[model samples]
Target chain A: MRGYTSDKDGYLTRLRRIEGQIRGPQRMVENDEYCIDVLTQIAAATKALQSVSLGLMDEHLKHCVAEAIAVGGDTADAKVREASEAIARLVRS
Target chain B: MRGYTSDKDGYLTRLRRIEGQIRGPQRMVENDEYCIDVLTQIAAATKALQSVSLGLMDEHLKHCVAEAIAVGGDTADAKVREASEAIARLVRS
Candidate 1:
């Protein structure tokens, strides 16, 4: 089971909100809104997405990584490595 | 007219795609997907949003901001200030 399984509903709610947020900029563009205004909406959506990422990362470390480390073996090392790479990708993105 | 007027279609298309991209994560969460996989999708959507912001910023600088600066007055200063703040928000987010 996934680390976020416990909070699946919460994550789904946030993601759905973000999906709606993205459409805000689309409507602004269709109406020829000012560039800065459209940009502001986009920035808001981007921040929302980032918040979700951070939340998921926290959950992953707390659950998945924690469980793997408890096992203490090659699996643990691979999990740590995989998580670090995922984090790097999150930071760069 | 907005700076992105020329590329309105492009911007709309990109925004629409991003809207769809956000749904990928929502579905993943609903299906109890791994935290890392869900995060990867979220990161992709965030990157796509950032790309759209950069494109809009480029257009703003080239057109709305440029035209305002050409006029050389208080409006120009305000426009520049607004654009700078927007850029700062983008960077922080």
Candidate 2:
């Protein structure tokens, strides 16, 4: 099981909400809504996505990484490296 | 008409593609995909959203904000302040 297994439903709900947030802007653009207003909505959605990423990162560190470290082997080293890379991508994105 | 009027179709297309990107991860989660893989997809979608915001911001500055500044009045000040706030939010997010 993945690190987020326990909170699977919560993550899915947030993701679905974000999908709606993204779609709303398309409608606003279609109707020629004010640029600032559309930007505001997009910012909100972006923040929401950021929040979700933080949550997933936390869970991954707490569970998956923790478990791998407990084993103390090449797998542990690889997992740590992989998690660091993912964090870097999230930060850069 | 909004600043993005000329690129409405392009923006819509990108937004629709982002919606799909967001949805793909839900399925990945449901299938118990690896944590890093899911996080990678989320980062990609987040980056795509950020790109769209940057594009909209550029258009807003070049068109709406430019026109308001060219008119030289209180409206220009308001637009500049508003755009600054939007930029701050995007940066924070």
Candidate 3:
């Protein structure tokens, strides 16, 4: 999350928009909109959120993980494990 | 994100906390804290975000997808595909 701080605002903005995207689908459902249309919107919103997660993961690797591995030790090992687990959780979700 | 609006505040609160958690690691990195420590914090933050995604997914299944399937048709097929792809993306992440 090194560069994350610098880009935090951008990320937050996108996530906020994503929240709206998600809300759009819910509203559609409430209005008894076509199920297919609602589902498609939900899919789009979900993908948008996933992109944020991917962006964070990229920054994490480029900064944190790389630095840890460079200064190899228990810390390095732990960083690797932490990242893998994070990826696993994302996949499982 | 059906019930998501009803519980939006709670979800937003948790996401904000996770944002702080991520910020913590960035600060740690800036301060040259141990790499393991920073990575661990990132892991926690990542997991927290994943939980949010899972909660959304669960609500989606129980509400949107369930309703679509109940009114089976092209919408049902689309809804199932949409959800499966979402799970796939999560797994790929």
Candidate 4:
């Protein structure tokens, strides 16, 4: 099964929550809620999103990267570079 | 259907390529490939990973976020905040 399949329930739940969280800001804008409050909510949503991304990245490294390495040869090196670049991008993001 | 479902094939192909890319760095380490070359490969992988993230984020905002806002009420503001925070985290990362 795909890594995603294993985490489907959790991922969907998080996404649903995120969906709700996103609505918060839109409503705030519609109602003209306090700027700080809206901004704070935005920040929270961002963190939540980052958490999701981090989780996925971790899984990718452990599964896909590890699998590639096990296969050996040029593929191993390719996997390592792929994982490293992914990490770099995550850090940059 | 989930957004991921629609992109399943593309995602898997990208992941497979990334898996190969990651191996490149590992082989470089084992074989003592040039540090510069390894680092360059790593950078490429990072960009590729970022591209994936950006695509996903875009989909999230368009589908889940938009759907939540359409429902209206407190949920709308919540979603807005969630999305903003996610973006902020991505930027920070």
Evaluate every candidate with DockQ and list the scores.
Answer: 0.92, 0.88, 0.10, 0.04
Tens-place lDDT digits, model 4, residues A1-93: 333345645655664575465556556545544333544555555566557556666666676667778998998899788667766755664
Q: Clash pairs of candidate 3? A: A90-B90, A91-B90, A91-B91
lDDT of all predictions, in order shown? 0.93, 0.93, 0.63, 0.58
Model 3 residue A43 CA deviation in Å? 12
Between 1 and 3, whose lDDT is larger? 1
Q: Total backbone clashes of model 4?
A: 48
Candidate number achieving the greatest DockQ relative to the actual structure: 1
lDDT at position B80, candidate 2: 95
Q: Give candidate 3 regions above 4 Å deviation.
A: A1-93, B1-3
Per-residue lDDT of model 3, residues A1-93, tens digit only: 363556766665665576566557445645545434544554565566556667777777888888889999999999888888878755554
**What stretches of model 4 exceed 4 Å from their correct place?**
B1-93
What TM-score would each prediction reach against the true structure?
A: 0.98, 0.98, 0.54, 0.49
Cα deviation at B46, candidate 1, in Å, is 0.7
- Residue-level lDDT of model 3, residues B1-93, one tens digit each, is 453556656655665565566557555655645434544554555556556667767777888889889999999999888888777655444
Model 2, B11-90: lDDT tens digits are: 99999999999999889888888888988999999999999999999999999999999998899999999999999999
Model 1 CA lDDT for position A9: 90
For model 1, the superposed segments whose C-alpha errors exceed 4 Å read none
Candidate 1 chain B lowest-lDDT run of ten: B25-34
For model 2, report the TM-score of its A chain. 0.98
Error of 2 at B34 (Å): 0.9
Query: Looking at the true structure's interface, with contacts defined as alpha carbon pairs within 8 Å between chains A and B, what fraction does model 1 recover?
Result: 0.94
Candidate 2 residue lDDT tens string, A15-55 = 99999999999999999999889989998998898898899
